[model samples]
Target: MSEQTGKQMSKEEKDARFEAELLPVLDPLYNFAYRLTLDEDDANDLVQETYLKAYRFFDYFEQGTNAKAWLFRILKNSFINEFRKKSKQPAKVDYSEVEGYYNTEDVEGESGVATTTDMRTESVQDLIGDEVASALNALPVDFRTVIILCDLEGFTYEEMAKILDIPIGTVRSRLHRARNSLKEKLEKYAKSMGYNGE
Candidate 1:
């Protein structure tokens, strides 16, 4: 790879750093995706698409820069684009009934136990994690995004602005509003748990 001097680099060297550096950020990418989409399948697909796009455009990436931030920008853009495109489409028809018909023999195999997992395994909010997650999930996507970027990812306002493609002032404003909204949500949860706002 180039020596951070904006010099030319060989493809092998680029590939080496691309894998070495970018792969480490995959967990954070997936976590960010999950927080954005709130669906495991969607998050997984978003992460996959981000990686593919990033790899295809690796030549444009500067060496010795903040790879995580770069990767995050790509992921956030991908999520927005993909989700927006999906929102514009009509609802899809699921074919689970036909699939289930074919799986009947497997479902009835051996002990014939019911395959469905019990939702009661986890209480609403599950005391803390679920409560916090539900509150976060309830937030508007824009506010949830600021929380994930600024608070969760620990990005500075300037860094967040660059990643989010917004002005630093806008980043600060959004972060303020988002935090306030999240606090209100958590306060409700705390009240439910007898916290009394202490």
Candidate 2:
């Protein structure tokens, strides 16, 4: 049956369909929202708003299409249109001074001696997850959103492009830049914590 026919379903049927199809996407949506807002309260608000919009427009959803992508698109649009508008902050900081840090050569002496410790030697990922999260939080909202959607949330580049209403090329480039930016931030944090470049 076509999606339009499905939309004419009874309330119970609609609810059943929604639960079966859409509910599974909630956790990912929540994670995406949390990363975007970086505040529990704001994340809750965004998720709630996303659901409301989704529920209201559920009939328009074409069955067999990617429900998660559809929901993400709604949530992203809501964020940009509503939440993003209210926050008139700059998207990027003046990190020019820190730019050189990223350009620094790998941990090798001029004589080609390996000076840096191997990152795999220390299982500090768990210890640093929170710090990495904080660094992600400190990033510009746009970059943070892309990172969470692509990395943490595990959305494909195409899915993210659909969600963000951007071209696939833009999605790839943004994800690359965001990851690089995140790595730079985490490296700074690691240094501060005396991680010895490991």
Candidate 3:
């Protein structure tokens, strides 16, 4: 095998390589961990444990591959294996719930006559970014993870799939649902703040 593609690295090499690549990813990984754990202390511990595991298994990583995805995969797995058990959180409410709620509401037809009160006069887009961030924090863990990774962190669907160990279709669907959920939550928050378009 070529030197670059050869068998696993020595202990020193592994430590060096992991330090070089994995350290820089700590902030992004911490952001993801915080989104999952929703606590600063837990996020720090989770990231530290993830780095330790990644360092121990550094040889398994292939050279010249997407290190970010590889590191993210390690972080995600560590979160699932360790933190998920203690959390006991339920998955986010599905799309059917949202659809059912909407369907139950009576609205105007194409004629545009009077109908049920449209209390949704305010758009969430008007909320400041920090308020949006807080609203994001209020989301369920599942939706928050997807939004942080895909929307805030700018990871592509394929990378997210690899990181989360799910199919790309699942990533896309979760992202769609997560964004809708965030929008709804942000709108509600903005309305609560008395943001009636001004």
Top TM-score: which candidate number?
1
Question: Can you write out model 2's per-residue Cα lDDT over 20-124, one digit (the tens) per residue?
Answer: 888899998898887776668777888889988887787888888999989888888888899877655676333433434433553223312221243456566
Report, for every candidate in turn, its global Cα lDDT versus the true structure: 0.75, 0.75, 0.71
How far is each candidate from the true structure, as Cα RMSD in Å? Answer: 10.3, 7.2, 8.6
User: Model 3: how large is the Cα RMSD against the reference?
Assistant: 8.6
Top-down lDDT ranking: 1, 2, 3
Pairs in steric clash, model 1: 125-131
> Distance from true position, residue 24, model 1, in Å?
0.5
Where does the lowest 10-residue lDDT sum fall in candidate 3? 107-116
Looking at model 2, report the run of 10 residues with the lowest lDDT sum. 107-116
User: For model 3, what is the C-alpha lDDT against the true structure?
Assistant: 0.71
Instruction: Tell me each candidate's TM-score.
Output: 0.75, 0.73, 0.71
TM-score of 2: 0.73
Kindly give the number of clashing pairs for every candidate.
Answer: 1, 0, 0
Across 60-146, the per-residue lDDT of candidate 3 in tens digits comes to: 777678877787788788888877676565663444455445434522242123211222553435335555776676666677888
Residue-level lDDT of model 1, residues 1-198, one tens digit each, is 335555655678777988998999998889999988777888888889999999878878887888899999998998887765774544522223333343344433331222222234655445467656766776787888898887788988888998999999998899899889778767644554446786
**TM-score for predicted model 1 compared with the true structure:** 0.75
Q: Candidate 3 has which clashing residue pairs, if any? A: none
